[model samples]
Target: MTVVFAALAVSRHLQDATGVSIQNLVRTLRTVRSATIRLGRHEITLALDIPAAAQAILDRLPPRGH
Candidate 1:
Protein backbone atom coordinates (compact mmCIF):
# COMPACT_ATOMS: atom_id res chain seq x y z
CA MET A 1 0.00 0.00 0.00
CA THR A 2 2.85 2.34 0.75
CA VAL A 3 4.44 1.53 -2.55
CA VAL A 4 1.14 2.15 -4.30
CA PHE A 5 0.82 5.49 -2.55
CA ALA A 6 4.38 6.37 -3.43
CA ALA A 7 3.79 5.41 -7.03
CA LEU A 8 0.66 7.51 -7.16
CA ALA A 9 2.51 10.33 -5.48
CA VAL A 10 5.06 10.39 -8.26
CA SER A 11 2.64 9.84 -11.10
CA ARG A 12 2.39 12.92 -13.28
CA HIS A 13 -0.97 11.84 -14.64
CA LEU A 14 -2.41 11.46 -11.18
CA GLN A 15 -1.01 14.82 -10.16
CA ASP A 16 -2.45 16.50 -13.24
CA ALA A 17 -5.77 14.79 -12.75
CA THR A 18 -6.03 15.67 -9.08
CA GLY A 19 -4.11 18.92 -9.00
CA VAL A 20 -2.25 17.61 -5.94
CA SER A 21 1.39 18.43 -5.88
CA ILE A 22 3.79 15.55 -5.41
CA GLN A 23 5.69 17.62 -2.93
CA ASN A 24 2.63 17.69 -0.72
CA LEU A 25 2.12 13.93 -0.97
CA VAL A 26 5.72 13.26 -0.08
CA ARG A 27 5.46 15.73 2.80
CA THR A 28 2.31 14.06 4.05
CA LEU A 29 3.89 10.62 3.89
CA ARG A 30 7.08 11.78 5.54
CA THR A 31 5.41 13.55 8.43
CA VAL A 32 2.45 11.52 9.60
CA ARG A 33 1.99 13.32 12.91
CA SER A 34 0.58 12.11 16.18
CA ALA A 35 -2.61 13.44 17.78
CA THR A 36 -3.60 14.41 21.31
CA ILE A 37 -6.94 15.20 22.90
CA ARG A 38 -8.52 15.71 26.29
CA LEU A 39 -11.91 14.40 27.28
CA GLY A 40 -13.59 15.28 30.55
CA ARG A 41 -10.78 14.86 33.07
CA HIS A 42 -8.65 12.53 31.03
CA GLU A 43 -6.06 13.03 28.37
CA ILE A 44 -5.49 10.82 25.38
CA THR A 45 -2.81 10.85 22.76
CA LEU A 46 -1.63 8.92 19.78
CA ALA A 47 2.01 8.62 18.89
CA LEU A 48 2.86 7.36 15.46
CA ASP A 49 6.12 6.07 14.16
CA ILE A 50 6.81 5.80 10.49
CA PRO A 51 5.64 2.39 9.38
CA ALA A 52 8.35 0.03 8.21
CA ALA A 53 6.55 -0.20 4.89
CA ALA A 54 6.58 3.54 4.51
CA GLN A 55 10.21 3.74 5.55
CA ALA A 56 11.07 1.21 2.91
CA ILE A 57 9.35 3.29 0.29
CA LEU A 58 11.12 6.40 1.47
CA ASP A 59 14.46 4.67 1.53
CA ARG A 60 14.13 3.65 -2.11
CA LEU A 61 13.48 7.17 -3.25
CA PRO A 62 16.31 9.04 -4.85
CA PRO A 63 17.90 11.64 -2.65
CA ARG A 64 17.20 15.30 -3.18
CA GLY A 65 19.58 17.04 -5.64
CA HIS A 66 19.89 13.85 -7.60
Candidate 2:
Protein backbone atom coordinates (compact mmCIF):
# COMPACT_ATOMS: atom_id res chain seq x y z
CA MET A 1 0.00 0.00 0.00
CA THR A 2 2.68 2.40 1.01
CA VAL A 3 4.83 1.37 -1.90
CA VAL A 4 1.97 2.00 -4.30
CA PHE A 5 1.37 5.42 -2.85
CA ALA A 6 5.06 6.09 -2.79
CA ALA A 7 5.28 5.15 -6.45
CA LEU A 8 2.51 7.59 -7.21
CA ALA A 9 4.19 10.33 -5.23
CA VAL A 10 7.55 9.61 -6.78
CA SER A 11 5.97 9.61 -10.22
CA ARG A 12 4.47 12.99 -9.56
CA HIS A 13 7.61 14.37 -8.06
CA LEU A 14 9.77 13.12 -10.89
CA GLN A 15 7.32 14.47 -13.42
CA ASP A 16 7.44 17.84 -11.79
CA ALA A 17 11.17 17.79 -11.40
CA THR A 18 11.89 16.61 -14.91
CA GLY A 19 9.03 18.46 -16.60
CA VAL A 20 7.51 15.15 -17.63
CA SER A 21 3.99 13.87 -16.98
CA ILE A 22 2.08 11.05 -15.33
CA GLN A 23 1.69 9.43 -18.72
CA ASN A 24 5.44 9.28 -19.14
CA LEU A 25 5.80 7.72 -15.73
CA VAL A 26 3.12 5.16 -16.58
CA ARG A 27 4.95 4.44 -19.79
CA THR A 28 8.00 3.59 -17.74
CA LEU A 29 5.93 1.33 -15.56
CA ARG A 30 4.73 -0.45 -18.66
CA THR A 31 8.30 -1.41 -19.40
CA VAL A 32 8.16 -3.82 -16.49
CA ARG A 33 6.15 -6.96 -15.72
CA SER A 34 8.07 -9.03 -13.19
CA ALA A 35 8.27 -5.91 -11.09
CA THR A 36 4.97 -6.10 -9.28
CA ILE A 37 3.22 -4.99 -6.18
CA ARG A 38 3.44 -7.94 -3.81
CA LEU A 39 0.51 -7.73 -1.45
CA GLY A 40 1.90 -10.26 0.99
CA ARG A 41 5.46 -9.00 1.11
CA HIS A 42 4.93 -5.28 0.48
CA GLU A 43 7.92 -5.13 -1.85
CA ILE A 44 8.77 -5.17 -5.53
CA THR A 45 10.36 -8.34 -6.85
CA LEU A 46 12.32 -8.25 -10.07
CA ALA A 47 11.83 -11.65 -11.61
CA LEU A 48 13.82 -12.95 -14.55
CA ASP A 49 11.00 -11.90 -16.86
CA ILE A 50 11.33 -8.19 -16.19
CA PRO A 51 11.82 -5.93 -19.16
CA ALA A 52 15.18 -4.48 -20.03
CA ALA A 53 13.97 -0.91 -19.83
CA ALA A 54 12.60 -1.49 -16.35
CA GLN A 55 15.80 -3.16 -15.28
CA ALA A 56 17.66 -0.13 -16.55
CA ILE A 57 15.48 2.19 -14.54
CA LEU A 58 15.84 0.08 -11.43
CA ASP A 59 19.55 -0.02 -11.95
CA ARG A 60 19.68 3.78 -12.19
CA LEU A 61 17.76 4.22 -8.97
CA PRO A 62 19.28 3.85 -5.57
CA PRO A 63 18.00 0.87 -3.63
CA ARG A 64 16.45 3.05 -0.91
CA GLY A 65 16.52 6.64 -1.92
CA HIS A 66 14.01 9.31 -2.80
Candidate 3:
Protein backbone atom coordinates (compact mmCIF):
# COMPACT_ATOMS: atom_id res chain seq x y z
CA MET A 1 0.00 0.00 0.00
CA THR A 2 2.81 2.39 0.75
CA VAL A 3 4.32 1.62 -2.59
CA VAL A 4 1.07 2.44 -4.30
CA PHE A 5 0.87 5.70 -2.41
CA ALA A 6 4.40 6.54 -3.44
CA ALA A 7 3.60 5.76 -7.03
CA LEU A 8 0.54 7.99 -6.81
CA ALA A 9 2.70 10.76 -5.45
CA VAL A 10 5.07 10.33 -8.40
CA SER A 11 2.12 10.34 -10.76
CA ARG A 12 0.86 13.56 -9.21
CA HIS A 13 4.24 15.15 -9.67
CA LEU A 14 4.40 14.01 -13.26
CA GLN A 15 0.91 15.36 -13.83
CA ASP A 16 1.95 18.72 -12.48
CA ALA A 17 5.10 18.76 -14.57
CA THR A 18 3.69 17.42 -17.84
CA GLY A 19 0.02 18.33 -17.62
CA VAL A 20 -1.01 14.75 -18.27
CA SER A 21 -3.61 12.95 -16.25
CA ILE A 22 -2.51 10.04 -14.08
CA GLN A 23 -5.01 7.77 -15.80
CA ASN A 24 -3.52 8.58 -19.18
CA LEU A 25 -0.01 7.97 -17.93
CA VAL A 26 -0.94 4.59 -16.53
CA ARG A 27 -2.86 3.71 -19.65
CA THR A 28 0.17 4.39 -21.80
CA LEU A 29 2.84 2.78 -19.69
CA ARG A 30 4.29 -0.47 -20.96
CA THR A 31 6.12 -1.13 -17.75
CA VAL A 32 5.99 0.21 -14.20
CA ARG A 33 7.95 -1.86 -11.74
CA SER A 34 8.95 -0.16 -8.49
CA ALA A 35 9.61 3.05 -6.64
CA THR A 36 12.43 4.00 -4.33
CA ILE A 37 12.56 6.75 -1.76
CA ARG A 38 15.65 8.03 -0.01
CA LEU A 39 15.84 9.66 3.37
CA GLY A 40 19.25 10.75 4.60
CA ARG A 41 21.58 7.84 3.98
CA HIS A 42 18.85 5.21 3.98
CA GLU A 43 16.66 4.11 1.13
CA ILE A 44 13.21 2.54 1.05
CA THR A 45 12.23 0.32 -1.81
CA LEU A 46 8.82 -1.01 -2.78
CA ALA A 47 7.95 -3.48 -5.46
CA LEU A 48 4.99 -3.03 -7.74
CA ASP A 49 3.45 -5.37 -10.24
CA ILE A 50 2.47 -3.44 -13.34
CA PRO A 51 -0.59 -5.33 -14.50
CA ALA A 52 -2.17 -5.44 -11.09
CA ALA A 53 -1.65 -1.76 -10.40
CA ALA A 54 -2.81 -0.67 -13.85
CA GLN A 55 -5.93 -2.77 -13.55
CA ALA A 56 -6.66 -1.33 -10.14
CA ILE A 57 -6.46 2.16 -11.57
CA LEU A 58 -8.54 1.27 -14.57
CA ASP A 59 -11.22 -0.27 -12.40
CA ARG A 60 -11.69 3.02 -10.59
CA LEU A 61 -12.13 5.11 -13.72
CA PRO A 62 -15.55 5.97 -15.00
CA PRO A 63 -16.59 4.10 -18.12
CA ARG A 64 -15.97 5.74 -21.47
CA GLY A 65 -18.53 7.94 -23.24
CA HIS A 66 -19.83 9.33 -20.02
Per lDDT, the best of the predicted structures is: 3
Write the residue-wise lDDT of candidate 2 on 3-63 in tens digits.
9999988787666655546686568667555555678868776665656655555565445
TM-score, each model?
Answer: 0.33, 0.39, 0.38
Question: lDDT at 21 for candidate 3?
Answer: 80
Off by over 4 Å in 3: 31-66
Model 3 CA lDDT for position 1: 100
Clashing residue pairs in candidate 2 are none
lDDT of 1 by residue, 1-66 (tens): 999987866676535644556675466566656888999999999877787655655565566766
Which stretches in model 1 have alpha-carbon errors above 4 Å? 1-9, 12-31, 34-48
Model 1 is weakest, by summed lDDT over 10 consecutive residues, at 12-21
Best by TM-score: 2
What is the C-alpha local distance difference test score of candidate 3? 0.69
**Clashing residue pair totals per candidate (backbone < 3 A):** 0, 0, 0
Evaluate residue 23 in candidate 3 and report its C-alpha lDDT on the 0 to 100 scale.
76
lDDT of 3 at 24: 77
* RMSD (Å) of each candidate, 1 decimal: 10.7, 7.5, 13.0
Off by over 4 Å in 2: 1-9, 12-22, 34-48
Q: What overall lDDT, based on C-alpha atoms, would model 2 receive against the true structure?
A: 0.65
